[model samples]
Target: MKKIGIGICIGIMCFSSFFSYGNEQVLPHHHQIQKGSASYIETINQEKNRYVNYGDGYMIDYPSHMEVDTSLEAVRTLIKDQEREIEIYYDNFHNTPNSAPAYKNYSNAFIKNTKDHIKEYENTATINGMKVHLLKWSRKKLSKVSNDKNFYVSAEIVKNDKEVYTIFIKSSRQFYNFEDYMDVISSFKIIEKKGNPSINTKFKPVERKLNEETKEFYYKYFVNSDKLRWGIFEQSAPASFSYLKGIENRLDYEFKFLVRYQSLDVPMPLEELKNAYNNNRYVELTLQTMHMNEENESITYDILDGKYDDYFEEYAKKIKEFNHPILFRLNNEMNGDWCVYSSYYSSKDTNLYKEVWKYIYHVFEKNGVDNVLWVWNPHDLSFPNFKWNHYLTYYPGDEYVDIIGLTGYNTGNYYPGEIWRSFEEVYPHVYNEYMDIFEQPFMITEFGSNEIGGDKVKWIHEMFDYMYMHPFKNIKVAIWWNGIDWDPLRNPARIYRLDNREDVMDTFRQRLKDYK
Candidate 1:
């Protein structure tokens, strides 16, 4: 993903050569070089050039030697030298969904519009406080022009609330000096709009007591369950709602879990949460504090070291207002290397993770948010070369946690050298290990298997059978992750959706009915 940006930059140059004109070519209306405009020319001739404001919401600095192009639509500006070129464009399509989906549409359009083969694409780069999606490919024109000289290209796309901006940098992979152009691209900045809402710092602590209905539901469904409560997690809210409606009609059982993700610094969607509660579902909120970059850990110890007390308090107050029992999985899968709170990124300081957990739990308690059932979740111990081996160390003690949660998956050859594993093989070892240490009821917070290397129907049957017949009988909740694992613009993994698979759905429906 990181390398794709660099590759696309060079590949675009081949396409550029066809459209680009020589120095003698007449300039466009916007970029006309006026005669006797010494001041403007002088500005462009300086070693460290002055910032060019595009009259849009962006400004950037370029080298004195480069030429700026202004003819292209959605392209804010373009700068080019002999060996390298950079193009900046912005999209304000009101009809498009979120940044991620818009990015996918743009990537597909680029491939279709320009006949270039995108070898790699990744949304991994973060620049100017915004996440950037990158695409890389080799130009088809280069193959026709010269067999010996292959042109590679890369593009970096950044999205804000209003618009999506792309920085297309093209250079010769062999001869271009990347460091020189990178400095110019890094200087790009977005002008702040007026009247942007500021983060609420004042802690408006609410004094709302827990609803008796919420307490009754929690006690009945979670604390003393006759059989495992079933649920499904889809990518979007509408999809999840539709899936639940369909499954409920077919199976004659209502879903008990509504799995949702809460990103860092973003407030919980109170309206959506309320709607889920109205539907009589328990929200399994996975509080994600980290961004995608594992190396660039955002949630540091200092930030969690009592600095955001007001923020946490306000968040707790909001949860209290919801007044529904939620399974709050804070920093879930802490033992895994993917999360920022994990010991792998925290200098192997599992104690810091525990401290952060305790701090958040304390804030919720302080704000009278007793409806939250704190779930201490960690990934299963089956992952190879797992850094945090002692899962007990990550625990914030038995008092803070109301339920022990585990995330186990039958990847089934999702990655190279990955073998198909049965349900028992994926989770039994970790379940037994945790059972020996914690007395709290267990929940498989996230569980699914792929139909790639093995039979998903058989795997689902095995999972249900094990849960029904297991002697421990403490595992009371299981949430199936129903989503597409393999997307064209991103990496591929396990596909866990069972709704479309009638065989699997029938087996699941029967198992739900048969389970005692």
Candidate 2:
């Protein structure tokens, strides 16, 4: 983790008051405010402070005056003032099934390791909606050359089912202000847990079309058949095609090629399309219209304002002129927070997102781009902040969509303190949830897992097994994200290719043979 300097001045004085609970005291911050209360309104207004996402399932608000260092291997986050320091540690403990035991073991280890005298300690305390163990201790200077000096420490240990977060704050006794630091501690909250639904809705059906070649391919592999169509995505079409040639040579099978076009800056790569067509391979084109630089904010206003009409019209003309059957997936993974069109920034207004989708589809249709097989994609609704009912609301109607595409990944511990999940655990819920609503063929537009923290070979093998045994019998296309996940911010980049790991590659080849 590298240290990125971000300045933000947060005025906490407005909500600096505290409330007592039993023997403990807690801050009346954003998390504590009631929905319609005055404090909630004030908190919302004052939420302009910078937030640091740990990517490990949690995020926290830090004041601008503090320097944050996330580069430490052991500590997830390091926040420092002139002399006062805060260290956040993300610990992975596999055997512990519950929080109580995990907290006790970690607390004992911390006390022993630091050689500190415990002035006060509480085995249980509630902070930021999590049950934590609190410890306040002090250590005196033992150096013979040094005069009498004392250092104060306040620590909180928060344990989840799979991980533990230890937040340690240290300062000289003269500078130690427990209340001020407590405000920072209370700002921490877990952001990656499964979403809790407040409502449910039926899945809306969409009508779509496929070209002659695409229809034949779908029938042969997916419709009324158990055979799976294998696909791969690389950074470039040439790279993907090269990888496909290697796979075909190894397994004696050809694969569908997946290509992605992002932002308004880059037009469709005609060379890539020509290469795929010339090589007798089908292409799955993912058209990402969202702005490349912006992911956190909503672009709904731009879409509704028709600011990109000329861009869409030109793209639509190109698609029509190309005159080849391609699986056109527009704005895939729209339900996930990583996209600008997601409900997170759209104020949970799915209708606005759907309008944008419909507008894009209408542009293509108006341009007579009939060769495109429209694929409507959304991230699995089980992800945090995604509501199940909201998933259906993003539908651009059956007339605009042809197939349902879903994206899922076994991310492992890519983020600090994240759990290593299996393929089955990450994808099945979405399939089960949507299968009954829409009577259309399914396609996994993106799927892969990190090699670290879990068995990638076993994960791949199980993915094929699950696909073969899947009850809906609608899943036709499964594409593996073959490129290296080179995001510098995330730990353990998820490499999901069959080229390097012989065991995993052999498993994939053998599984494809079995499917055949």
After superposing candidate 1, which stretches have Cα over 4 Å from the reference?
1-215, 238-240, 292-296, 305-307, 382-389, 487-491
The alpha-carbon deviation from the true structure for residue 212 of candidate 2, after best TM-score superposition, in angstroms, is 4.7
Error of 1 at 448 (Å): 0.7
lDDT of 1: 0.59
lDDT of 1 at 495: 78
Highest-TM-score candidate? 2
Give the 10-residue window scoring lowest on summed lDDT in candidate 1.
1-10
For model 2 the local lDDT of residue 76 reads 42
lDDT of 1 by residue, 51-161 (tens): 323334565666766665432212234466666566565555455444545444434342442322334433466667776655554433221112222233334445555
For residues 56-135, write the lDDT of model 2, one tens digit per residue.
Answer: 45545555456554332122445666656666555554663435454445344434423334455445678867877666
lDDT (0 to 1) per candidate: 0.59, 0.59
Clash count per candidate: 12, 3
**Lowest-sum lDDT 10-residue window in model 2:** 32-41
